[model samples]
Target: MTLEHKRPRLEIEYCTQCRWLPRATWMAQELLTTFEKELGEVARVPGTGGVFEVRLDGEGVWSRKSDAAFTDAAELKRLVRDRIAPDRTLGHSER
Candidate 1:
């Protein structure tokens, strides 16, 4: 018998403005904490508007987990509501 579980997931938008976005790091940390609570982990690649692969421990990440982690999406109304805007205000892929 096997107990199936959902994989942990997070999206990180690395800065493409040449300057670092500290908030992005904070976002990842917050996700790590959230996932950790569920006994899961994430796989991340460091790059501007980078994609992250998330899953349970031992289920190493794959390229498929990646997507558009950057850009100021109109869909991110919650992100805008939740945090202060960056001085740069440029999404990872903006450049």
Candidate 2:
């Protein structure tokens, strides 16, 4: 019998005190729409003290505080796609 590999899970942790839920939700929606089949799940985690991070399988992929900027939708898509589906084309998002 062949074993099936599990898809990657995305976690977006945003600061609740900073009111970043809308941002996190937007990012989650974008990721879900872009990688609906490639991703196993997308989770929104509540945080504090200006924390905004994205992780795949518990590994940090992007951090707003560290980067000093919010991650763009296309950039985040590329980052996630590279890890989950390296060969997959992102069409207009490539630019």
TM-score winner among the candidates?
Answer: 2
TM-score of each model, paired residue for residue = 0.34, 0.94
Tens-digit lDDT track for model 2 on 6-75?
7888999999999999999999999999999988899999999999999999999999978987979999
Residue 47 of model 1, lDDT score: 57
Candidate 1 error regions (>4 Å) = 1-3, 49-95
lDDT of 1 by residue, 1-95 (tens): 13565544444434445443464455456545433544344333355543333222434222223444442333232332233223323343233
Question: What does the lDDT read for residue 67 in candidate 1?
Answer: 48
Q: After superposition, how far is residue 66 of candidate 1 from its true place, in Å?
A: 18
Candidate 2 wrong stretches, greater than 4 Å: 1-3
Q: Which ten residues in a row have the lowest lDDT in candidate 2?
A: 1-10
lDDT of each: 0.39, 0.93
